[model samples]
Target: MLLALYAALGVVALPRLLSQVAWFERAPRLAIAMWQAACASVVVSALLAALAVAVPASVLGHGLADFFEACATLLSHGVPFTSASARIALLLAGVLVVRITYCAACVLLSARRERRRHAEMLAIVGRHDSRLGAMVVDYDECMAYCLPGRHGLPVITTGALRTLTSAQTAAVLAHEHAHLRGRHHLVLAAVRTLVRAFSGAPLFARASSEIARLVELLADDVAARGHPRVHIAAALVGLATGRVPDFALGAGGETALVRVRRLLDPVEPLRQRERLVGILTIGVLLAGPAAVAAMPGVRAFLAHYCESFIF
Candidate 1:
């Protein structure tokens, strides 16, 4: 039952609620953390629920010793699943593991391929820019973005160099630098992997889009530390129509217009108390499902020890 609730929340409730939350737009880092916690909680809760169903209460009642024995039985001849529910749970667990692993591999491999291709392109057509501390690609498009890897390089186009003022260019570079510094691409890649693996799942799709947007907002925040918000907004406008490689984090994209508006009309930063509350909320969202999932084992442990003491 707990597992079902978690699955429902992950697949339906949380995604819908989060999509509608305007506060998340104001506090993007907190929002990112919440999304991550929510995703992890759902996965963990689902696995625990599967285990709970597969291993009978009789086995769990005997505590850790019997738990390991049951695991060994499962590995050897497989446990005699007396109930259809047990068989279904075991099957679900297997499917989850395989799905997650395959999706992760796909994401990694695809990223590597993209990076390799981009690197080759950069080697041929890209020039080093000491002033900007980035690679200058001699393209006509007004673009600025960063390709992330061991040899991660920020790239700006000749067109962008002509289009943006010195301050605007600085702001754009700062934004891309933040992306590279924070390793934001990995966060995006992970969510995207889940989406690819579960193409039918609206939750993963929503998560992918939301996380991507939040990371952009986060990068904007970082850039704002070093450059005027107005300059950054201007840079966003200058680069709004520019194109970057699919794998790269660009200064302008679908969120650019909204980001520009945000920069121009910035909201006050969250108060310390509000930040604390947000942190606590993330903690509860992550821990609640886990605690609920562990209850059966905890209860069984207490019951077994109490029975022993009584005897």
Candidate 2:
């Protein structure tokens, strides 16, 4: 019986398990880590339950009646619902729900609220031009940030505007344009969701930050691809790692280190690893659920009872 449960869990959780390890060992970024951890939590919890139960399958044959009989007999010893295994699952699910809820609140409060805040602040610093883009200077000791919405947020500071050459200004504009064009802020919000979703899991925070950095890299590429380096360089120096107001556009923020490094020396490549290792990790993770699913009795239980447990 224990074997049957473990096997079933392994099958059901296999895909998620493999994905967790694959993402963790590979990019080790935030979104990937969150997913890996969340999935890993459920699968690992099940594995531990299986270990505790130590059930012995009473019947094994091609016959359906035998499968049902054995399952019934083994479970009658101690139904899984009241077992320690079920308790682990219950705890994990509760924690995950809280984590996801907190994450959503953070994003809604952080990036989403910033949009409204900017709308009010913009009237004082910059005017809206549907075609030319909006500009502002925010002195709030925050790093310069540009987020996209119905209209583009293009922030230029009194200091930055005063310091940079027109060429630099254009370069800065190009960089922010990249952010607005690519919807980088929304991507960051999504990454944040991934980050908080797996708050208790290892490497999840690093992965989320990496994803943010990657988006910045992507934006930098768009801004600098066809322009003179000096302009963007000047812009980065002007932005210089301060917190631009939440309501304004700035050339840099969380990704400042990577951007500076790339600007200084541009040959860095994305990390690559042995595909086989990633594949195996993915295989192990994926096996978690599929293994569970493959057991007919477990599947029946899930379909009839446990499905309700899934949020």
In order, candidate lDDTs are 0.84, 0.56
Q: What RMSD does each model have against the real structure?
A: 3.4, 9.9
Tens digits of per-residue lDDT for model 1 on 1-311? 87767776677777887788677878888999888877777777788788788876657768678889878877799657789998999899899989998989989898989999999989888998887899998887787889998888789999899889999999999999999999898898888877887787777788888898889989999999989999999888877645343456655455877798889999788889878988997898788876776677788878888988999
How many pairs collide in each candidate, listed in order? Answer: 0, 46
Question: Among these predicted structures, which one has the highest TM-score?
Answer: 1
Model 2 root mean square deviation, Cα atoms: 9.9
Over 4 Å off in model 1, which ranges? 61-66, 77-79, 241-254
State the local distance difference test value for candidate 1: 0.84
Q: Each candidate's TM vs. the true structure? A: 0.90, 0.55
Q: Model 2 off-target regions past 4 Å?
A: 1-84, 129-132, 138-144, 194-202, 241-258, 268-311
Mind sharing the TM-score for model 2?
Answer: 0.55
User: Which candidate leads the pack in lDDT?
Assistant: 1
- Give the 10-residue window scoring lowest on summed lDDT in candidate 2: 52-61
